[model samples]
Target: MASDTDIGSPERPTRPGRWRWLPGSRLGRLIIVLNLVGLTILISGALVLNELRRGLVNARIDSLTTQGELLATIIDQAATVGEPEPMMDGAYAAEILQLLSNPRSQRARLFDAEGRLIADSYWVSDRVEWRTLPPARTRGDGPGLDLNLSGGSEDDPDSADAAKAQAALRAEVNTALRGVHWAGLRVGVDGERVVSVSIPIQHVKAVLGVLTLEARDVDEIIAAERAALLPFILIAVAVSLMSSLLLNRLVAHPVRRLARAADRVRLARARAISVPDISRRDDELGDLSRSLEDMTHALSERIDAIERFAADVAHEIRNPLTSLRSAVETLGLVEEPAARDRLMAVLQNDVQRLDRLVTDISNASRLDAELSREAPTPVDLRRLISDVVSLYQATARLGEPAVTFTAPEGLETVMVSGQEGALGQVLRNLIDNARSFSAPDGVVRVALGRQKGQALIMVDDDGPGIPPENLENIFERFYTSRPKGTAFGGNSGLGLSIARQIILAHDGTVRAENRRRDTSTEGDAPEAAGDIAGARFTVILPEARR
Candidate 1:
């Protein structure tokens, strides 16, 4: 139930779960997933490119090993100088190296058994120097080693490893001198990678010279590999950007607008809720917009009903208040005892009327809340009508109207689903209304029957029939069509209206119509053929499921 403070007011406080931050928002989470997917795609592409690079370099190294073997065989026959030390014929080997080289791709070189350079395709030299003077360096007192100033400190691990690596020709020649072929990837001093292969020229265990093949364009190969990955990179970037834009336009912006609209509702600047244009879409956001609008509209209607009910309550209470005030004022002015007694009676009646009106108004106002709190259950119309009529019979006076109940023959039960307490009150109200209209010796009969899959309850009174025009008006609030000589303020005039409201809430119908006399003839209107005998009220309710 809404509190008095919240009723009919736009300033009612909202719950705390509405304000969420960016990462908690729907769009933020979507963007996070998109970015994660893009990162996965990028990492997967990099891994693929890395594997491709390794395969290409390994294949190149194998190719160089094969080529080096072929060149070593050729050099063994061509290199025939210095038999004791096994030197290479510089001119013949140089020609072979030049023929084997593929310009900037692979380099071919020949080294003597003594690990001296014999020929090089890059140098184009017929005969390379067998020995060269060492570079000038400062003497270190700690050891006999010389530190070349231009080559950096000899103690530096990077420099020392780089210097050892730069002697690729000597390392291959030394390995080949041991009569073993060497081929694999090696890092150059400049941090570039190369595929190197070295093989020795030998004739029956007599080593001649070493032939080495090195592919120095590994950087270009890596560059090509990266170039091949460009498409995947571009696609990942495009998808990320597209997803961001789509989320912002379709989700984030609309949600933000909804938040702003909710803020406006919180501020109570407007009675209606309005979201963004996204409500036009046929999606979840649109559903949310429609639901919010409907909720606000319902609240506004409830507030209006409350305001009207309050006004009606004030008006109803004022009439009796005005009477009570007038009676009290006149009681003091009246000097005669009989007139004073009349004034006192008037005051008492007004007070009682005020109390009755207040009680009925309270019940009518709380009807909605009370009905909502109570769950509906199957109510046997026969039993219910019997109980209400028995109560009225017990309370009936000697000269008052007598109440009786009748049910369909052989019909064991006619049940409808509703709050039994509320429906019982409905019965009491209808019976009381019927008794009030009936003559002193008249009968108020209640009947229960089933018709068209519905439970029907009819209350009949042997009294003057309702006016044709007031048949409908009789069910309206504050509408009373009492007979002459009846005590004023006897009825609060809300019983019928409250009854109708409760029946409607239970998905039932109630209406007032006059019963026709037995003299009515066929093919003639009831009023034209026979006079109206008495008033009859029929209540219809859906039969309860078995």
Candidate 2:
């Protein structure tokens, strides 16, 4: 039994993780990745240095092993001369050790089978202790120490530590005396990396002595390897800088300019947006720029249309108002009963005219908004026209023109995509327009069919044909031209105009033309004397796809 509050409660939202500080802007994201290229270069350089260090140390060990094997071969010959006791010839061994000694950056040593130090290359050479001083003590002291410095202090604690480290070297030699070669890295008493290798001296399966080699300058080799990566680091930095510059110029700067142009339009400082530099580009940003321009232009046109419509409405309302005022003022002065009755009749007419005009204007104003609110569906034009015409026929008076709908022969339906209510209103207006001009006995005909993948509906009447010059003018708002007998202001001119608007909104076209009697042209029907018959209004709409 959980309460509604508990059940409906949402979980707390999690905050974004690291790297969320990156800006949401496109340019900011590009700049971040571009600059990270420099970091990538640093990481790759470090990896390359590490690999070089390993390779160089391994090569040093291999060289030491090779040199030791040659020296061990010579020492094995000298030590094997007294085999059962395994005694080294001191003079011969010393000569061999001296020839191989390298005291400046490397050391060579020889150990007997019993683990006793036989000879050391370091003792044979001149022992210059100042050159071998530890970096910590040397850097701490003054720089101008005597250049001829001979040796370290005999009682120095650091010197005693170095003697103890030399004893630890015996373990590596002893491992070789057990008949196995050894090679590895170790830190010396002076805190420098030493590449050590030891090989056993043997004569026909009898171990005699051990030959050992040490490369003391491994740190220098690693430093040189890092220095070699300098050029790559410089190239990466230059590439990153170039990328940032190009992105700012070609992408970020142009977008910012377009944003500023749109802001001007929003603030009404400019009538429309024109991001010329961005629009010239052939990309998505260019499409956005062009769309903004088109939207602003459309808004400007709509504003102009609204201003003109307001002026027309005022002009149309003023006519009826003036007439009503004249009729009202004259009613009090009319002496005869018939004159007073006529004056009252004029008042009623003007009042009715005002009502009709207001109603039509209201409908026209809301037409565009209402159409946009409703989603369009497939509308069957044949059925829609038939329904409207049937309603009219059902309510017809004795002298009113009869309404009829005709569809193509053998055609079941003609469909178009549009709002049903809107399309229905369009048909009703067209039919009513035709009826207004028709004679008492004339028929207002609605013919529906399809042609060239378009739905076509033609409203025809047996009324007087529209004058050719005024055919297009008839669709203009508040422009009415009725028959002589028809009462003034009986119909508002907005009907045809509203019909055209709704049709156009549905991506359809409407036009007016006169239907004429057939003329004889070699075996054709004979021409009627009057030539003109009645006006025909045709509408063409895109056909609905399956």
Candidate 3:
């Protein structure tokens, strides 16, 4: 059962559970959504970065390999030359030394066929400095494949202090002569990353001479790439951050505003709700806000309607009370048999009026309760409608004219779950109202079937058609429109109203409209007898299992 306080509250307004509220509401949802989006972008970026690093490293290795091969080809071709060009200065000599001193060569030797040094790129002042170069770590691939450069070409530093770095370069290249791959040496003045390549000369598998030159430019290339990586990464990260911030503002901000507006509307106590009167702009958020504002206005109108009904109910009941009291006073003065009977009749009519008022009040009060009530067992709606119309047709025939049924095919097994009595009462009331407005010999048409997820039961009469104004008010309690000088158009005026109440209690709906009248029979149609002169009442009930 719902609470009394809850009854006054709109059931559709409040819902249970987490309630979609946030710290600043929409802003928080925006932050969370953007953060998740940004995080996904960052993760994807990191994967791309790692792959880029691997590609850069592989590219560097390929460059280094090509450089080594070029140096080796140069050494092979140069080794065929005789003694050093006689006018060679020290600078030219150092260049030549680098060409012959490459460590990847198996040996960098300068020897005559008699086996004496002509000019070993790895030999400086005819003394070997073991400490200048690390020992070769692996054996040559095999005999002829080996270049076998001379080993440890530098003298000890104590003996060659002024040319220590040059000597050190010579020694490193000689040690690498076991099998030179690639090499670097900062040989000139403080070892500034200057380097060389060397290959030994051999004829008929015998040592002949050595050829040497500066080695591939590994140090310079490594230095350049390392410096460029940081700036490139920095620019990429900056762009990503700026883009994310712009997206948060452009996309998330408007959505947050709409969410806040919706929340405030829900929290409001007044029946009239407005959301700052937003316009229907082209943007998506603007459209959403404008729609919310429109919905609020419409909702307020419905609330106003319910409130007016509450007032109308009170006003309507007051008239009958006043009349019933007057009739009671008049009955106390009965002086003859005829006067007494007339006065008694007036009192009875007033009692019936009170009953009608009370019934309307009770029906209105129970709308919510009945809306929530569990349905009764399923009853085939065709059978229910047929039974009601058949019984009421007899009543109609006794009045102004005959009642006729207009059931179509496919209405046989259509069903619904509701109180059978309540449903039957709705149909009988419609038929009774139809008869009241109908002139003698006028026609009453009844229909029953299924449509749009509900069973449809309709009653139409060719009677004094409904006025456009009273079409809405006909179902109001104590709302009668009996033409003067007529004893017909009967009842305490709650027939249609009670009928609507019963249909609605079954999770259904009922509505009335003035049917189009026949021009040929216009003069013959009854006048001012019902909510409408040419009225039609439609009752809809939910479909149930047959």
Instruction: Please name the candidate that would achieve the greatest lDDT relative to the true structure.
Output: 2
Off by over 4 Å in 1: 1-233, 255-268, 274-280, 374-418, 449-453, 526-529, 543-546
What candidate 2 gets wrong by more than 4 Å, as runs, is: 1-229, 275-278, 281-285, 374-376, 393-398, 413-415, 520-530
- The better-scoring model by lDDT among 1 and 2 is 2
Question: What lDDT is obtained when candidate 3 is compared to the true structure?
Answer: 0.57
Q: TM-scores across all candidates?
A: 0.63, 0.69, 0.52
lDDT of 3 by residue, 224-258 (tens): 66566657656766665565556546555555555
Lowest-lDDT window of 10 residues in candidate 2?
Answer: 146-155
Give the whole-model CA lDDT for all candidates, comma-separated.
0.76, 0.78, 0.57
User: Which of the predicted structures, 1 or 3, would earn the higher TM-score when compared with the native?
Assistant: 1
**Residue range 488-516, candidate 1, lDDT tens digits:** 78788899999999999999999999987
Q: Please report the TM-score between candidate 3 and the true structure.
A: 0.52
Give RMSD to native, each candidate. Answer: 8.6, 9.7, 11.9
Which residue pairs collide, candidate 2? Answer: none
